[model samples]
Target: MASIRRLVLDVLKPVEVATVSFARELSDLDGVDATAVRLVETDREVQNVTLVVEGEAVDFERVEACIESLGGTLHSVDEVVCGEFVPEEHVAHADATWLR
Candidate 1:
């Protein structure tokens, strides 16, 4: 069975620099290592931006809380994606790593 991890991504208020930093930080997460978490479109009219996050389910809630703490509104959270590693694929390299 897969050890499913959860994740949630939050978009901090965007200034180019802040968005860049957020993207970098998110890339270092456990399951989803996203190189980009960008504001695609915005309601600059009201300051609402459509932010996209590429990450995993295991770390979802914590990530959501983080965004809220950072002054970003979490508009929605859906199970957008999932991932799993097959142990059988590692059989050939069983002695090569510790995760198995």
Candidate 2:
């Protein structure tokens, strides 16, 4: 089976909890090496967030459960990286080249 090494998710969550707290909680799960959550947009009661999770083999079911437990709704899976050995992208220059 191909191991899930990276995942990018779009989530909608209540504002009561902090994104860092969610990241910390996700990082505590099995196989999760790290997590990064960024606020994309916000309304009065909820925040739209983009979540990036990295692991040797990410348990997606557990991750979804964790999100629900934290009062978050999974919107969509934007990106995913999975394989026995996933290659990392390295950029020589720090510029918005991809955007141009």
Highest lDDT: give the candidate number: 2
Candidate 1, residues 1-49, lDDT tens digits: the string is: 3333433333436343365555555555566545445455555332333
lDDT of 2: 0.93
Clashes of 2: 0
What TM-score, computed on C-alpha atoms, does each candidate reach?
0.48, 0.83
lDDT of 2 by residue, 1-100 (tens): 8889999999999998888889999999999999999999999899999999999999999999999999999999998889876577767677747864
Clashing pairs in 2: none
TM-score of 1: 0.48
Off by over 4 Å in 2: 85-100
